[model samples]
Target: MSTAAVPDLAVVASPWTLGPLTLPNRVVMGSMHTGLEVHDDGGAGLAAFYRERAAGGAACIITGGIAVSDEARGGPDFAVFGVDGADERFRVAVQAVHDEGGTILAQLFHAGRYALVGGMVDRHGDPQRAVAPSALPWAAARGVVPEELTASEVERTIEDFAAAARSARDIGFDGVEIMASEGYLVNQFCSPLTNLREDAWGGTPEKRRRFAVSVVRAVRAAVPDLAVTIRLSGADLMPGSTTDDEVDALVHDLLPLGLDGISVGIGWHESRTPTVQAAVPHGAWLAYASRIARVVRGSDHPGVRVIASNRMTDLRDGEAVLADGLLDAVALARPFLADPAIVSRSVDGRFDLVNTCIGCNQACLDRSIIGAPVSCLVNPRAGREVAFPVRPTTQPRRVDVVGGGPAGLAAAVDAARRGHRVTLWEAADELGGQFGLAALVPGKEDYAATVRAARAELDQRGATVHLGRPATAADLVGSDAVVLAPGVVPRSVDIPGVELPHVQTYEQALRDGVPAGTVAVIGGGGIGVDTAAFLTESPDESLRARAFAERWDVTVADDVLGPLPQRQPVAQRTTRPGEQVTVLRRSGKFGQGVGLTSRWVALGRLRDAGVRMVGGVQEYLRIEPGALWIRDEDGVERAVPADHVVVCAGQERLEHSLESALASAGVPFALVGGARDARSVDAVRATSEALEAVRSLAP
Candidate 1:
């Protein structure tokens, strides 16, 4: 296959300058919470995190929000710029990025009322108090109200900002971006909703802008040669919050402070109008930055640059926004998590190969909230970049990838990229296996993007793809190693009524179509409920709603009577009146078939969708010319009506007894997809295992 032409991804030189430096690219690595910092040492881990991105291709890497004062720290692990004796560590972090040929920026911040001081103990092990504009706490809690910043305290805080900036410059940082957005301290003072003080720093927009403007001015003065940037919230997006005009007026007033650039972020997750809770589309936050750019263009600060960021994942979106003069640069957060080489791939015209972020939030923000090391849901090698760097093998070997799902694809891509000759075999005509079924769920189209990206990468790396081929142990006779990635198979119970014509497996219903109407899905496991939900779609309601309805009809059957034990909701599940749905759950060990997280979401959706729960159906009997006859837990036989029955039980690993047949024939073989295992997770794992096995056998 001929190589495709790459796109022109060269960074445009901006005429606008920042202090004594000029950025070559408009792609800025925005300040992101990695939850990898060590509270005690504040060491090289955080520094290396920034340096890796710099080495990957970011023009400017902004450090995660670093609190300038002890009282303003949001969490215990947040990096602190004011920590005593921490200057050397911060200097090393800055130098790491500088050594990697990238500009580094420190984001100085104060959490204000958002501070978890009382919840977070000081280094002395004393519980601290949280401070804010008013007595208002976060929406989720009503803990201790913060004492309003006194006139002297406010002045000291401004000095802290300047001091932090000065310290950042001393540590070799190219500049400092004041984090004034996302409902932090500066943002609290900037908005009327948060700052209700009668002091000079409150009331009107001009008064509210005082604290931020002072910080910018003081920081610029402290670090004359270092570029000073302001990260502002263009609009609070909260009810009774700062309006666009109010934000515009504040920007206009603050532009003359000689700041180098502006970054516009959105929504406070804890605020009534939190960005995380908002259902806004991708790049929805760019409009605010565009408005800021227009305001700056009208003012004397035409040379001031503007950066836009908010869930931006596609380079095309960034390119269009920049081309239209909406903003000077676009910032991406999750996309970088999904694929660190996004810019490199785009420049190489391999957009299809880009492993797109599905916005599942499972590994990124979700994991951080639970105090786990951050990772990507689809890409397991995210935070482990340095630990598991993909290097070319000294000797080329043949690698066979049995399953073509996410894990298999990742393994194949990695092995092939490492200079191995890889062969990926799929039992099915297409790839993805169970993930393909997942894509059919509402709001899950993004999952399919992972498969597409894997296929693209495999094609690019010249991995041989053999479709509709199932390999056995004999196929690995001459191979030095063998990987068994045969995917999973459905685990079906030998129920009396399950053999009826209306009964079908979840996979069958997905690949083949079922008539729309009332449907009873057996088992309330993730796959069962998900399969039921996928059938509820009519191309009218939102995908989320349809998925919810499907989830509702699925239930966990309990044989012990009383009430059915519930699983957590996966997608929002809802069912309309008169919708035909029933869930049968067996007692004891028979019902535990799904992962905990997926089970929760699935159960929640099932209950919300009004799915009927029928438990203890061990002795179901078919009633001729009417409903089906069944026996309850008390050994009582009963009759229940149903149009179609779908089996959603668990799956088993793939088993092929024909290994000797193919191996004896001296066939170069591979196994792929669900033919490896009945379980989805195992199926993905098998793909890589199979690939490694093939490589070992290759001479």
Candidate 2:
């Protein structure tokens, strides 16, 4: 092992040999469903999608697992490999990637019990029925019980795996990968909870290993010249499922079966584990990949590469993981979805220009999980890259933006990049509007990075920025076009005693400090839950210091105090464990509007804080000096004692005085972001509006 002071990160950008082929770089695009298939053209849209990522500098692209058989298939959105004319379209995709100096691999998979029952047609064009080793329902997809695969059926399934690999190699794929992770078919057979079969495929660890090993052996025999890889879950993160030690043994057993590489995965969709969400700390699962790598390195064919994945958002961290000597390469799914040029930007030392993935799985995974076309919230051109290529405007105009928030910043940067004269104004002294406040919430600091990237782009494009000045009609006199993106204003509930001085809005509470003592947060939306998290945060600086120390293996004193002892009492004092906070909402569910994946982690944090939660508020009677009166869900009235009351019900659009003024002057104005729609204020809506407004203004 090289113990050099600084491990060369250029190695990540260097060529590496995998079996008979040498890849251009160490970076591999992780396989994921893009929902960009063309039913009429046999997945031509999907071809263009992978073409964009390959052009952006991915060394190799692994297509989303292509269904081997009709019975073990993903939904209609997933690309089918062996269907009529589908192989021809896949050949086009493979040529597209190869033309761009990249290799494309086909991930052949069988969904097994996890297959969407009745949602897809079989390989022979019949209604698809899911089959598994045992007749059990997949926990992730409720109400879908799979039929048990008969002994003869299991033999055919193994043959199907070999046929898929042969089909991939014949269609000009650079390699093949078996999907054995994420609670899919291979994973189901490996887990005792899902596979209760008393046959040869189950009842023991070695027997369970038989199915996966047999598939690999069959694929290798079918395609002797092409490379073969397997993606395996290092830990299922669920009860009665495979653990790290078991995965270690399993990989060691399969290495001698002509496998070229292994990628370690963490968690399953049905498992009650937080894996890839933004709330999961960055590089949290690298340790799992290290464990698997150790087992493979000790084996006979130790040269086989190991890839690490889950929540690796940037190249610097990827470089660090590679430097640790645990894994050979790091794979990114959402980061590439967020910015396909992540590798090229990093290679050019343009880290500031790279648009980082914030891991807000809103558009990418969450939308795809519900059958929507996959996209990026920040980039806005993910799946539609072929449709919306960024080009220089034919005719540009002088544009003035009225806010320095996400919408205004995005518009200014994009318009300026298109050779337009753009200027952005902010009433506040800073750039990020609500995004800055969002960063203050625990476990959400990554949002601020997006703001920073926007700022960098604005600087690079030379867009004029005016801070501490609100754009008005006078300032827009000479502008050919004006954009109204003043964002939104907090709305307080209408009730008696609502105007009390103690009643604070969510924004005010975050900008200012939470009042000392008990606090009651009203509303259970994303804003409310986050505010509750902020209020209930540990007050001990030492505790936070200790946490950081333990996580990074640094040393911290237990009672360490900072300079200015009197002013920073909390820095030296112990935690205030008795400090209480209550969250109330009119709706039954909490954390609405929070991204589906991150909501789990957010709620878990609030639970750990011991926050008192009450929903279905019958009424907000009034507010007094020491308490607020409200009715509970059971039709009972009560006085909730609190030193401070926070209202996070929602926000109202700011008054449109600027719009009316621009209209009177005929300034050819537009409204973007919360100024136009305050229903769901998120990066997706804000960035989408900005991209559309900028593109439409072009002649």
Candidate 3:
């Protein structure tokens, strides 16, 4: 091993060769489901999507899961190799990426018991049933048990894998990454919990390894010159699953198979460890990849590249990881969704201009989980590159956006990008309206980065931003069009002692700390859940691997934290551990409106904080010095005692007088975001509305 000092940026920018392919840099655009794979656009939108990202400077791109067979299809949105005209579509996508000087790969995937099948038909016009190693059903999708693949059927599946690889090479792909990670078919065969068979496939460790080994061997024989890589689960993060020693042994056994690369994947879909959540910290899973890298480097094929992935949101973070020389490359999936030009912007030292992924899951993962069309919350034109093309308009107009929140900021930036003269005004001293408040929450520290990037983009586009005051009606007199997004105000509950001195709204409590004692909070919506997290916040929500694992009950193996895991903390102060917080809800889930993937994690944090949760409250009678009176759903009146009170009922639309004034003066104006409708503080809807509003007002 060589010991030398390389600048952090230089480390990640350095290029390396993976067998037949020579990548330009260490950043790989990792695979993510865009939900546009099955769109009826003849693959035009999908082709354009990858084309722009390649042009933006990703060294290599990995396509979303491409099923090897119809039974292996994950859902209706999955693109299969030989079904539904996906082969012709993939050929176009591959050419598009190559034209822009980027290499693309086809990830061969099989969902096993995780497949979502309903109306899919086979060759004989019969409903296709999901096939797995055993006849067990994934607990998450309880009602559907998968059929155990017969001995002959399993051998045919191996051939199907080989056939898919041959087709991928024929279609002009630079590589083929066998999907053996994230609780998929290959991963299921490795885990004892999922694979229960007395046959040659699952009697022991070596037998369990047969399926993945045979698949890799077949795929390699079919495509000899192509990069033959396999993605393996470095850590399943599931209790009573595959052990670390078993995982390392599997890699040791596959060393002489002429493999080109290995990409490390972490966690399972059913794991509760919070692997990719915002609270997991940046580059939290690198140690798993480093461990695999060490195992490979000590073997005969040390030249095989090893890639680290998961929660790598910034290039600077990736640079730091590469500086240690433990891993060869860094793969980022969602960061590319937040900014396709991330590689170009970060390499050029334009960090402020890069839109960072906040890990809110509002638009990406939440939508993809349910098979909906996926888009970015910050970069709205992510999947729709053709529909929302960014170019100079033939005729530009003077457009003014009021309120410098999520909606207003998005509108102002997009309007300026279209060659319009744009100006944004905010009543506060700074921008980021609700985002500013959100940044104060414990796990949401990344929200502040969004504000920083948005502010820089406004300046770069020559769009003026006025702070410390609201947009006056006179200021909009000469504007050709006005977009109002004044945002929302807290709604007051009709309780008798609501205006008590000790009571405060959710906004005030988040911005300024509440009283340091027992507190009773009303309502259990998203904001209320955030309030609970804030009130019961730790002295410091640590970014170190051990602390995170300990907090979430993930038993990390001995040396998985790596050497440089603890250099910073999100917060560090004295916390009142014994302080009690009682949360009351009327009727529903506690963390409603929180993203589907994130709600459980947030609730887990609150549970660890020793919060007293009570639901089914029918009435809020009154409040006094010691406690608040309320009636329960059991037809019983009781007093919830507390030292302080917080109300998080909901939000109301901020009535903009400027809208009526602009209309009276014959100025064309439109209300967007919370100023138009304030059902909840929905940033996904806000950014979507802002994008549509700006595009509709084209020159």
The most accurate candidate by TM-score is 3
What are the per-residue Cα lDDT tens digits for candidate 1 across 1-699?
111224444432233355677655667888876765443345566666666677666668787777887777776666666465466667777887888777888889898887765467765667866777676877533466777888888999999998888878877889999999988999999888889988888888888889988888899899988888888887775777888888888888788888888888876655433233112234545556777899988888887888888755666556656765646887777777777766656656676877877665666676564446776766666665555556678888766666676656766777777788877767788898777877766535566778888888888888888778765554445443334455676787776657767778888877665654556666655576666556653322233332322343211111101121111123443333325676666553222444322334445445555666677667655532234556778788776555666777778766765445545656454444455444544422343344444444442
Alpha-carbon RMSD of each model: 9.0, 5.0, 3.0
lDDT of 2 by residue, 1-699 (tens): 111112335667766777777876677899988766534565566777787788877877888878887776667666566676778888888988888878888998888887776556666667778899899886565687888999899889989989999899989998898999988888888888787888899998889888999999999999999988899997887876776677887898899998888987777887666777755556666667887888888889899889988876777767667755657887888888877777876777666777778778998888877768888887787787656666687777888888877777778777887788888999899988887787776546666677787787778888889999988788997888787888888886886776888889998887776667777888888899888877765444334444434543323222222221111123221222323788888875799888877787677767766787888889888888778789888888899877778899888787757887878888877898988989777768887887788666643
Per-residue accuracy of model 3 over 321-383 as CA lDDT, tens digit each: 787677899899888888888887777777788888988887888888888888988888888
Each prediction's whole-model lDDT (CA): 0.66, 0.77, 0.83
TM-score of 2: 0.91
Global CA lDDT of candidate 2, please? 0.77
- Please give the TM-score that candidate 3 achieves against the real structure: 0.95
- Against the hidden reference, what TM-scores do the models get? 0.76, 0.91, 0.95
Ranking by TM-score: 3, 2, 1
Q: Which has the better TM-score: candidate 1, or candidate 3? A: 3
Candidate with maximal lDDT: 3
Q: Give the lDDT ranking, best first.
A: 3, 2, 1
